[model samples]
Each structure stands twice: as structure tokens, then as C-alpha cells.
Target: MKLGILFSGQGAQKAGMGADLYAALPAYRETIDQASAILGYDLQAVANDEAKITQTAYAQPAILAMSNAIINALGDVLPTPVAGLGLSLGEYSALTASGVMDFNQAVAIIKDRGIYMQTVGEANPGKMVAVMGDDQALIESVLAALQAAGKRVYPANYNTFAQLVIGGVAADVDAAVEALTDAGIQRMVELPVSGAFHTPLLKDAALQLTTRLAGETFKATQYPVYSNTTGSVFTADTLFETLTKQIISPTYFAQALQKMLDDGVDTLIEVGPSDTLIKFAKKIAPKDVKRYAITDVDSFNAVRDLLLAEGKEA
Candidate 1:
């Protein structure tokens, strides 16, 4: 079966994410240990510490490590994915998985990326709000009007057709929230993040990440991987710029998923913690396209058995 892998992004991480898998699976354990070595500390320890896991610096690498561990745990039976994509921070994990970058370099870069984003966010003091509505046109028009009226709000993430996020300076975001509320939309939730990520407020963070990324070597990808910034597969020429722009741009995740579905990915798996991306897939993908989110041993086995069964059937 053709497969599409979706890696988890930040914000869904919790304390004790992959402890069970680490204890039970040797390959998983080995991968986590390698990440811990590259990171110069216990990656699992950082994950179990609530305060540390919540911090952006620790969370990004920990999540990437967890995603990689799941991939390792899948072992040789795992089918090569035809394509893959990830939300926000998870893009680095996808790149690593697809062989565009080494795992060691990816982990190290993500650590610094978290630090840079958190530092810049603290200094700038902005906010993000998830706007819940099906009317993409209305949401864009409202945000555009606000922008024209000197409010700094921008559409940060296009998660689904029904839901998107907006972020900017705190006051401006609050104003946009009010405006949307007045325009008969009331369901807006402020995200618990330190920075207005995926907006121009994080431009400094993006610049820092660009400089950090320059040191690493990026190889040709094994298979197509969708770009969150472009809502299409990443090309060799556009990889670097797309990665940098992803920091201060709206992530077209819905568009990316549509592209994957259109490209004939019959099976979709969300790797790493949380079922967030899978839920999004459920909304966007056809019912016949098998979708599973593998966060732990049980979920992993379920998907493994399904794939093996499918292979036997074939």
C-alpha cells in the first residue's frame, strides 16, 4: 500500500511521552539513546520533566527524537512512505525521516531552533489564536481588513478548511479576536505558546535558524515530502528558503494533505506523540484511506498488524 507519514509538531508534547516504548523496544531505545548522546543529556529525562517538556527548547528535540524512535521501532517491516509532511516543528522530523538531513544534525538544529524562537518570542511578546470557523473567505477578509486598519494580525496556520490560526502583537491579536467575534464568530482559543510563531513576529527567530541551518548538509530526499510553506512537495532548489520562510508564514497543512491524497497515498500514519495530525487527516481524507496515529506500543502493533495483514492479502 502506498503510505504517507505525518510527524507530530510541538505543543502536543507531554511529560513521559515515550517511556513505555523505550522500555519495551530495543531499536526505539537505541534511537533515543543516540539522540540523548547528540543532545548531551537524557532525552527521556527531559521528556518526563513537565517543566522541561513544556519549554520550547526541550520540547522540539524531544518530539523529534520520539518521532524517530517510533520509526526505528517499526523496523524492517515498515513500508517506505511515498510521501510525508509535518506540522511546524515536525517538518524537521519529516526531513530527517526522508533522509534530507541526518538525525544527529536534525536534533541539534531543533534544540537551537527552540532556543532561538523562545528567546525572540520573549523579547517580542506576541500571541496566537485558533479561529474556529468553516468560512475561510470570511476569516481572510476579516484578517485582511484588520491588517489594512493597522492591526498586525496574520493567518498563521491553515490547519483545515474549518479551522485556522491568527497571530501577531498581543493587542492586535486581541483586537482581531474581538472583530471576528463581532462578525458572528466566537470560537477562538489562544494557544499556550511563548511566541507568535508562523507570523512575521518570529522573523528574527527564522533568521537565526537560517544561519544555524547553513552549517548542515542536506541530501536529496528518498521520496517526496510536502512543504508546509508551499503546500506542495519540496524541490531541491526551494528546500532551504521554504524551511526558513516556514517560520514566518502560514502553514498550508490542509493543502499539503490534499496534495498527498491526490498523489495516491492510500495509508496515512501519524508518527510520534498525540493524535492531532491524524484528526486533521480524518477531516480531510476519504473514509477508505486507512489512517492511524501510532504514539505507543499498542498503537504501533495495531498498525503493524494491519500492514502485515494487508501484505498477506496482497
Candidate 2:
């Protein structure tokens, strides 16, 4: 049974995400403690407190901490030989799991990254909106009209054939939404994010992160890891440099999942707060592939049972 792990990005966080894992797994608590020491902030508090989870500075580390905690807890039951990929900010957690970056370094980098992005958001007001339903040509046409009108709008994420996200200046984003609505598009919800992530507006943060990443030590991965930047698998040799590039590059999560399928991955597992990635993957992956998400203790147990049942069937 070939397995793959997916990590969540910025918007997937919720309060008390890792509380169960921290209580059930000693290693998880230890990992959180180490992260708190490195970050000089209580990671557990951030996970349990909604106020802290909403702040970018705390959210990034908190999400990363939760992801690491889940993976570590799963370690007691699952092996570490699976392939992995993370979405946007989740890419840092993927690197840590893949052995490209140490846990503490990953935590520190995400903390700095969150702070930088928050600062950028304050300087330039922006917004992101998720557009659902399948109308690729229509969506493109709407975006083009917005751009032709001098609006700073662009497609930030191609989540699925049925889902896309656009980001840019607040006015431009609002205009894009209005245009899409006029075109009869429903389910256009503006995300709660403070900045236009994955777009050129984050260029400054990306550049700053590159410099900080260069100072960190990255080891070769023992397992295959996919790159959200290019939607391709990376070896131990190119992990660090590719991770640095992933900061500014748009995440090709859909493409990455396709690549994983092409590579013969049969079991897809998302290790984080939500099943968003697995949901996306199931929409696009081959019919024979199985999808699993380990978001909380219940989902974790469900996945274990599913895997065991599959084994018995085989």
C-alpha cells in the first residue's frame, strides 16, 4: 500500500486543532514544547485559543505544530516511508516531515514568515475569494476583463475543476467577485485571509524568506516529496532550493496530486486540520485510488480502520 501525506495551508486552521493529539501522544507534547521554546510563544495556547489561531504570527506556527503533532502521533501506528506534499504554508511542514528541515528550524522560519506576511498585509490591503463551480473559460474571461480594467487580480489557486481562488487588491477582488456574480456564478466567498497570498503581492515576503532559508541547514530526504511550486516530485538533492522557490511560486496542488497518481500512489492521506486537500484529490484522482484524511482523533481512527479493512479485503 503506497501512501502519501498532505499538509494544510493558512486558512485551514481552527482552535483546539492539536489538543487531542497532544493529550494522546507524549511525543506530540514534547514537539510542541520544543516549538514553543524556539518560538518564545505557547504553541499549545495558540491551538486551544481562537484569538491566537487567527493571528498570522501565531497561526502559522500553530498550524505547523498541529501538522507535526499529527504526523508524529501517526508514527506510532504508521511507517515513515510515504510520499508527502504540503499546500502553500503547509509546504514548510512537508519539508520537516521529509527531513529537509529540522522541526525547530521549520517552526522559526514559519514564525518569521507569518510575521513578514502580516506586515505586508498591513502595508497593502488585499483580499482573496474562492470561486466554485466549473466554468474555466468563463472564469478566465472574467479575470481577464478585471485585469484589462487595470485591476490587480489574478487566479491564485486552481483547487479543482469546480473550485478556483482569485486574489489581489481589495477593490479589484471585490470587482472580480461582482463580475463573477453578474456572470451567474454562485458560491463566491471571500476568504478571511489578510493578504493576497500566492500572488506577486507576496514578492517581498518571498524574497526575505529566501535569504532566511539560505542560512538554514537542510538535509536530504529519505522519502519522495512533491513540490507545490512545480507539481513534481523532488529528491533529497533539490529539496532546499525547491522549498525556497515555493515561497513565491503559486501552488500547483492539483497538478501535484496528478503527478502523484502518475507515480502510482494508491493511498492519499492528509495529515492536518481538514480534509480539503483530500477532497480536492478525490475530485481529480483516478477512480481506483483511495483517499484518507487524518484531521482529528476520530478521523485518524477511521483511516486506520479503513486501511485495515483494505488489508483484509486484499
Candidate 3:
């Protein structure tokens, strides 16, 4: 019953998230309070503010704080995972979970990261679109053709074999949508994000984040924490580079999931505000692998009891 955990990223945030847990659990309240102190404002207020919560600057830290609060509420009753991975901004949560970075420091760094990314996005507007299909070759071919034609579009996220996200200049992204539709790939959804994240357009943001991270200290992880940029585990040597490049590099999330599967993680739990990662896991993981999404009180209680029961049975 080896467990692997997935932390929620930026896009998973929603207004009024964590309110139930904050009200019902002492540990959860304590964690959020701690985050609020570090952040210099009330975290709950930001979470309830729809307009502010959607903005990257607040969203990143808020999501991280929420995810960590969920974990704190569960405490040691939850099994210690063999490994963990996060999508984009959630990677900092993974670092915190694994003991590689202090929670306070991680929240602080993410706040700056969010602000830098937002600044870049506003200065150089770009777009991201979720593409759905199974043909990797065809997808790459279209992207290559677009690049050859001088469009800035690039694959931003390899979410699964069935879904890939493309991002770049707004005009180029719109053109890619047309090209993809013409190529008989019609399923696409425009993401509600402020920047062309994981594309070259975020180079400036990455550079700014790099300078910010230079001052932080990282410790050895208690368990392996996978990298979204490299599709593998992070080491002391590659930590800084992988985290910085992740800002502008396409996330190899499917590959990271596969690596965790190969490493014998049969029970996967997603801890965050949304169940999106679990949805992606369903498409990739084998039918036998158990998956759970723990977002709110009901889901958390259900997963906790089930896991404890299963542990007793084992």
C-alpha cells in the first residue's frame, strides 16, 4: 500500500475554498493562521475574495496554504507517502511536504513568484489553450509547423496522453487553435490564466524567480519529490535549475506520474482544493491502482477512514 501524493497547483484555486476545514478542524485553522501571519494579511479573506483569489499573486500562496492546511489537519494518521509531486506552483507545496523547504519560506517565495509572473504576463500578454486528443505525433507535428511559421506557441503541459496544453503569444495561440481544428483536432478549452505559463514568454518571470530563490536554503527531502520540468526526482544539484526552468518549460506531468507508478505507488491521493489531478490520474493509471481526491471535509473524512481501515486490514 505504498502511497503517492499530488498537491494542487494554481488553476485549482476557488473562492471560499477551505472554509469548512478551517471551521471544523483546529490543526487546519492553526496552519492557515500561521500562513496569514507570514503573508502579512488574512489568508481566509483572500480565499473568499473571488477577484483577488483569481489573480496569480494571491492565488499561488493561497493554494499552497490551503493544501498544507489540509495535510496539517490530517497529521500523522495519514500514511507517510513514498513520494510526492505537484503541478507548477504546487511544486513548492511538495517541497514543503517533503521537508526540503520550510513552510514559511515556501509561502514567502511563492508570493514573490506569483507577483513576478503576473508582472511579466501583464507586460507581455499571452494565452493558453487545453488541447485534447490521443495522437502525440500529430500534436507535435502541428506545433512544429506553427513554430516554423514563426509563431511563439509551444506545448506548455503534457497532462496526459489525451490532453496537452499549448501556450504562447495571444495571436499565435489563436492561430494554433485554428490550425488544430483544421487538423481535425477540435476539442479545446481556453484556460482562465493570466500568463502563457511554461512557455518561452515566461523567461523573464523565470529569471526574476531565479534571483529570488538564490537566497533561500533547501534541505534534503525526507522522501523523493518529483520534478514537473524534468519528469523525475529532484536532487540537491538539480533543485534550483529544475524549479527555475519550470516557470518557462513545458511540464512533463504524465511522465512524472508514470515514474511514480513504476516506483510502486499503488495508492494515489490528491490533496488540494480541486479534483483535477485525480481526473488526470484516472486516464493514466492502471484500473487496479486506487485513487482518492481529498479536497473538503467529506472527502477528507472518507479518505482518512478508508485508509486507516485498509491499513488495519493489511
Candidate 4:
């Protein structure tokens, strides 16, 4: 039975995330404790408390901690061998799972990344908005119109036929949404993000991350790991560079899902706080594929039962 794991990015985080895992699994608590020491912050509070969990500085580390904790828990209960992929910041979780980065290093990097992104967001003053029921051509037309008007905006995520995200200066995003609405292109909703991520506006953050990435060491993965930058398998030599570019590059989650389907991934398990990735994958993937989101004890048990049934059938 071939299984693929997907990790959710930023925006999927919520208060009380991973508290169950921390309470039910000693390993999860230990992992969070070690991450807290490395980050010099209270990871448990960030995960359990609403105020702290919403801050970009705290949320990034909290999400990474929870995703890694889930992977650790799965290691004890599920098969060790499986393919992995992550969206945006979730890519760090995928790297750690693939053995390219250790848990401590991954946590530290994401903490720094969150700080850098927050800094850039403040300096540039940008925002992200989600556009539903639109095609790429319509999005491109809106972007072109914004550019013509001396406003910088671009597509950040191609989530699905029903969902896409645009990022740029707040005023420009608002203008583009108005134009799209007038044209009856799509429904645009403002996202609760700090800045224009995965766009040229984040070049400063990307440059800083490049330097940090050069100093780190990455190991080859025992299992295949898909990359968000290219929606392709990552090799050891290109892993760090690809990860660096991903900071300023739009995530190809839709393409990655298609690639997993082509690779015969019969089952997809999303390991994180939300079911967003699994839900998106189900909408985009072939109809025969099975999907599951293991966010809590009940969901994990259900996935375990399904895997057992598949094994028995095989």
C-alpha cells in the first residue's frame, strides 16, 4: 500500500492545536519541550493559547512543532516508509520527515523564517486575498491590469479550480479584487496573512534565507520528497536551493497533487492541525484515490483502520 503524507502551511493553524498529541504521547511533549528550548519560547502556550498562536512569530514555530510531533507519533504506529510533501512553510516539516533536516534545525529555521517574514511584511505593507471560481487567464488579466496601473500583484497559490490566492500591496489587491468583481471573474476574499508571501515582495526574506541555507547540511532522503517550488521530487544537491527559492516562489500544490497521483499514491494522509490540504487534494486528485486527515486521535484511528484493511486486501 503506497501512502503519501501532506503537511499544511501557514493559515491552517488554530488555537489548541497539538494539545491532544502532547497529552496523549510523551514523545510529543518531549519534542515540543526541546523545540521550546531551541526557540526560547513557550511552544505549549503558543499551541494552546489563542493570542500567542495567532502571532506570525509564534504561529510558524507552533505549526512546525505540531506537524513534527504528528510525524513522530505516526512513526510509532504506522509504516516507516512513505512519500512526503508540504505546502509553503510546511515544506520544513517535509524536509525533517525526509531526514534532510533534524527536528531541532527545522524548528530553528522556521522560527527565523517567521521573524523574517514578519519583518518584511511590516516593511513592505502588503496583503493576500483569496479568489474563488476563477481561471488562470482571468487572474493573469487582473494582474496585468494591476501592473498597468503601476500596482504590483501576482498569483501566490493555485489551490484549485475553485480557489486561488493573490498577493501584493494591500491597496493594489483591493483594486484588483474590485476589477475582478466588476468583470464577474471570481469572488475575492481577503486573507488574514501579514504580507505578500511567495511574491517578489519577499525577495529580501528569500535572500536572507539563502545565506542561512548555505550554512546548513542536508542529507538524502530514504523516501521520496516532493518540492513546492517545482512540484517535483527533490534531489540532495538541489534541495537547499529549491527550498530557498520556495520562500519567494508560488507553491505548486495542485501540480504536486497531480504528480503524486501519477506516481500511484493510493492513499494520502495529511498530518497537521487542519484538514484543508486533504480536502483540497480530494477535490483535485483522481476519484479513485483515498484521502485522510490525521489531526486528532479519532482521525488517526480511522486512518489506521483503513490502512489495515488495505493491507489485508493486498
Candidate 5:
């Protein structure tokens, strides 16, 4: 079975995500230490802080460092990843894993990206909500109605077959949620993000990031890295443009996974904290394919042993 690497995004982060890995593995410790030095703060300390970890500025780089450290620490035991895919901000980590960039470059830019997004968020003061347990057409109509009414709400992420992350101006988002609730929608849990990510409201952040991304050097990829904006393997030449557009466009994660599946990625492995991407993968992945996640020490050992065993057999 071919193995595909997955990276988790902002909301998937939690307190103490990579601390165990750092304590147990020298590689992890070095990787985290390297990232911390570049970031001008202790990466683990920032992630461990309850309040800091949730803030966009801290969370983005924290998750990137944690995820990249785990992948880097795994070394040759990982059996040469077949492809890489990440949710939103995780895409940068995926690129680092694929050799498009190094860990230091990724964390530095990711921190700046987060700060820029937060800046735009502060200026706009928007909101995002997960629209759950509703028909896709119905949800689309709801979003379309909001647009027609000039309320500014839109579907920011297409996470699963049924779940959508909606983003808009705070009051417009609130009004949209209220309307959906009154129209028999059962769930619309507001995300605790600082801005309306992956929506037009973040256009300023996207523009700022475009200039930042242009300065960074990117190498050719070792394997396919799917784009959240186009939901397919992105052109390396246009990488910066694709990533910039991703900030203001809806992330077609469901479609991205489908494209990976179509290309024969059978065993999906989540390389960061929590199973948020795994949960979304399960919703769209075929029943026959397998799924794994490497989060803490135990999970790391489990997937490591399995990969080592698979390696021995081959």
C-alpha cells in the first residue's frame, strides 16, 4: 500500500502537541529547537501556553513546527512518502516535507503569514462557523442567499461531504447562522479563529503574503503536493500564486482528497496533532483504504513500528 502524508491546520492544534516527541527523540528536539530559534521564541513553550496556542500568530507557526519536527524526526523509517497534502496552513508544512522548502524557511514565513492574517482579521473582525448535518444544496442556497442580500457571508472551506466552514463579517456571519438555525439547520459551531480565513475578507492578507512568498526560494517537489485552492497537484512554477489565492478562496479539501485517491493513495497518514484531517478523510475516502495518525509518543511508536515492519517485509 502506498503511504500519503497529511498535515493538520490551525484549529487542529492543542496544548502540548509535540512536547512528548521532542522529549523522546533527539531529532525532534533539534528540529523544534531550530524552529524556535528562527521564530525568536520557544516553540514548545508557545504551543504549551493555553491562551497563546489559540491565537493565530502563535498557532500557525506552532502547528507547522510540531508537524514538521515529527516528519523530520521520523527519518528513513517513514518509507519515502508517496505524496503530501495539508489543510490550509498545513500546506506549508507539506511543502517543507516534500523538499519544496526547508523547516526554517517554512516556520519563518508561516509566522509572518499568521501575523498578517491576524492583522487583516483585526481590521475586518470576522467569524467562521462549521455548517454541519445539512444538505449541500441547501447549504449553498443559504450562502447564496446571504450573498444576494449583500450580507458578505460565504463558504470558506469544503471540509467533508457534509460539513462546510462558513466565513464572513462578524455580524453578517451571526445573522446567517441565526437564519440557518431558524430554517431547521441544527449545528453551526463558531470557530475560535481571529479572522475570516479562506474568504474574500482575507484578501489583504493574501496580497501581503504574495509579496512575502515571492522572496522565499522554493525547490522542485519530490512528490505531488495537492493544492487547497485548485484541489489537484499544483504547478511548481506557479506555487506562490496558488498559495496566495488559497487565502481568499475556499479550500476544496474534499476534492483534494478525492484527487489523491484517484491517483492511488491508499493509506493516508496524518502527520500532526489530532485526527481533524483524518476525520475529514474518512468522510470522503473509500472504505477499503487505511488511515493512521502520528500525534504523541504512543501514536508515533505505533505508526513507526508498522512502517518499519512494512519496510522489513519489502
Candidate 6:
């Protein structure tokens, strides 16, 4: 089976995300241990602490550590993946798994990236709203109208055909929602996020990340790693630059999924605490295939056993 691996991004993290993974797999425990050492904090402590788990500085590394642990535990049960992609911070997890960035270095860089974004978020204090029940053109029209009106809003995530998320100053986001509602849109909802992620509002954060990214090395990927920024494969030479751009650019998630499907990726395994990526991919492609989310010990074991049995049969 052609496989694609996915790592969860922010907004899906929660306390106790990795407890079952740690308890069921020794390798996963050690992976978290090593990652915690590199991060200078106990990942379990961070994962079990509700408040701390939500903070970007801790959340990014914790999710990375858990996702990597899950990947490590997959071992031979996971055949070489056709492609790997992650949403936002999950990109680092994908890169680490792809061998483009050394695991320890990835942990450090992701932690820093989170801290910088968090700093920028606190200073700017923006809001993100999910606008549904419309096409991208309509979403763009609304944002364009806002921009023309001198509102600070921008498109953040193109999650699906009908779902587009926009972000900016809190007041601007609210105003846009009000305008869209007045325009007869039925499904506009605000997201409870801390920052205007994936928008130019994060340009300052992206610049800080650029300086930090300069000091790191991104090696060639072991597999095709679709980029969220361009919704296409990213080369090693362009990885750092594109990752920097992803901070202030819209995350083309739907396009990236389409890229994987066009590349013949039929099976997708979401490795993280939430099934967000798996659900999103299936919603976009809506094709019948082997798709699953391994979020805990039971889910992990089920996937491992199922795939290992299939391998033997093949």
C-alpha cells in the first residue's frame, strides 16, 4: 500500500496526549526521553499539564516528541512512506521523520519557533475565524473587501473547499464575520486560537524565525515532503526558506493533500493525538482507502498489527 504519514499541528494538542504511547512502547518512551532532554523539560510533565500543554513553547516540542515517538514505534510495520506532510508546527515533525532535520535540532528549532510565534501573538493579540458555507472565491472576496476597507485581516488557512480560515486583529476578524453574516453566509465561527497564524501579521515572527533557521541545517528528505506553504513538494535547498515563508503565508492544506493524492498516495496514517489531519484529508479526497489515526496505545497496536498482517499476506 502506498502510504502517507501525517503529524498533527497546533490547536489539537491537549494534556496526557502521550501517556498510552509511553506506557505501551518502550521505544516511544525513550524517544520522548531523548526529546525532553534536548528540550530541557520532561515531555510527560508538559503533556500532563493542561495549561503548559497549550503554550506554544511547550506544545510544539511536546507534540513533536510524541509524534516522533509514534513514528519510531511504527518501525518496520511502516513501509517507506510515499510522502509526509504536516500542518503548521507539524511540519517540523514531518521533517524530523523525513531525516531532513536531525531530531534534536528539530526539537530545538520547533521550540524556538513556537516561542517566537507566541511572543508575536501576545504582542499583537489577534483572532482567527473559520468561514464556511462558501467557495474560496467568496472567501477571498470577503477578505479583499476587508483589505480594501483597511481592515488588518488576511487569509490564514485554506482548510477545505468550503472552509477558509481568516485572521487578523481581533476586532477586524469580528468585523469580517459580521460583514459575511450580513452578506447571508450561514457558517462563520471564531476559532479559539492565540495568534493570527499563517498570515502576514506574523511577519515579525517569521523574520525572527529566519535568523534562527539560518543557523540550522536541513538535509535532503528521505521521501517527498509536501509543503504547506506551496502545497507542493519542497526540496532541501528550499526547505528552510519555505518554512520561514509558511509562518506568514496561507497554509494550502487542501492543495498539499491533492498533491499527495496525485502522487498516488492512497493510504494515510495520522500520527498524533488528534485525527484532524486524517479527517481533513478524507474530507477533501473522500476516496475509499486505508486511512487511520493512531492517537493512543490501542490505536497504535491496532494499526501495527493490521499492517504487519497485511505485509505478511503481501
Structural similarity to truth (TM-score) of each candidate? 0.98, 0.91, 0.98, 0.94, 0.96, 0.98
Error of 2 at 284 (Å): 1.6
Q: Write the per-residue lDDT of candidate 6 for residues 1-314, one digit (tens) a residue.
A: 88989889898798899897898799999999998888888889889999998887788888888899999998888889999989988888998899998888988888899899999988888999988875678778887999998999998998877788999999998888888888778887888788999888888999999999887767888998889898888897788789889899999888898889888888899998899988788778756767899999989988999889889988
Q: How many clashing pairs in candidate 1?
A: 0
lDDT of 6: 0.87
Model 6 lDDT at residue 223? 92
For candidate 6, the 10 contiguous residues with the lowest summed lDDT are 281-290
Residue 313's lDDT within candidate 4 is 80
User: What are the per-residue Cα lDDT tens digits for candidate 5 across 1-314?
Assistant: 68888999988888888888988999988988998899999989988898898888999998888888888778999877678899999999999999998888888899899999888889988899999964867878888998998999998999987899999998999988988888788987898788899999989999999999877788999899998888888677779789989989999888898888888888999988788899899888988989998999999999889888888999
How much is the lDDT of residue 231 in candidate 5?
87
Off by over 4 Å in 2: 80-82, 182-184, 235-245, 304-314
lDDT per residue (tens digit) for residues 1-314 in model 2 = 78888888888888888788777778778888899999987788878898878878788888888888777766645656468888888888887888878888889889898998888777777898989978867988999988998889888887777788888899888888889989999788888888888777877877787787777767887687788777777765676667666655667788887777777788888888888898899799887888888877788778767766766776
lDDT, candidate 3, residue 238?
A: 97
Deviating ranges (above 4 Å) for candidate 4: 80-82, 308-314
The sequence of per-residue lDDT tens digits that candidate 1 reaches over residues 210-239 is 998786778999999999999988888999
Candidate 1, 39: how far from true, in Å?
0.9
lDDT (tens digit, per residue) of candidate 3 on 36-108: 9989999988998989999999999999998888888888777889899899988899989899998899989
Superior by lDDT: candidate 3 or candidate 5: 3
Clashes of each: 0, 0, 0, 0, 0, 0
Q: After superposing candidate 3, which stretches have Cα over 4 Å from the reference? A: none
Return the clash pairs for model 6, or none: none
In terms of lDDT, the poorest run of 10 residues in model 5 is: 133-142
